[model samples]
Target: MGNIVKSLESSLATGNLQKMSETMDQFEKQFVNMEVQAEFMESAMAGSTSLSTPEGE
Candidate 1:
């Protein structure tokens, strides 16, 4: 996340849409990894506690 933020800041400083797009891809990758981890944690916790999420999600 910090890496993405720094990358985005640099891209903004240079006004580089290409770099910003690359940073967005990095951010998407981070989100994917996070979701995977969250799912794993929820799966692991399911046996002990009910997994919770916001309504409609």
Candidate 2:
């Protein structure tokens, strides 16, 4: 009986570790995508304003 309980506990611990690893991987991917989007918006705005400026007043 004691050995059976130990086996079950080990299995549960392994599963939990796997889930934590997968969650962190997904979080990293999402963070990188957000950073790219922010950079694109900043450059686009700068270009737009520069184009609209009047020439030689």
Candidate 3:
């Protein structure tokens, strides 16, 4: 993420539209992947919590 931001800033400083666009695309893909992983983790945690709880309480 930091790398992507740095790349974007560098591209902007150098007036490289193509590099900026590519960096943005890469960032978007990484963002989407992170979201998916987060959702999966949340679901896995929820499942574990339920399994560990007492049957009646």
The prediction achieving the highest TM-score against the true structure is 3
Cα-based lDDT for every prediction? 0.90, 0.70, 0.99
lDDT of 1 by residue, 1-57 (tens): 998999999999999999999999989999999999999998889845544654566
lDDT of 2 by residue, 1-57 (tens): 344355546656777766555555566776788899999999999899889988874
Q: What is the lDDT of candidate 3?
A: 0.99
| CA lDDT, candidate 1, residue 8 | 99
Candidate 2 clashing pairs? none
Per-candidate clashes come to 0, 0, 0
Query: 2 or 3, which is superior by TM-score?
Result: 3
Ranking by TM-score: 3, 1, 2
Reference-based TM-score, model 2: 0.64
Output the number of the lDDT-best candidate: 3
Better of 1 and 2 by lDDT: 1
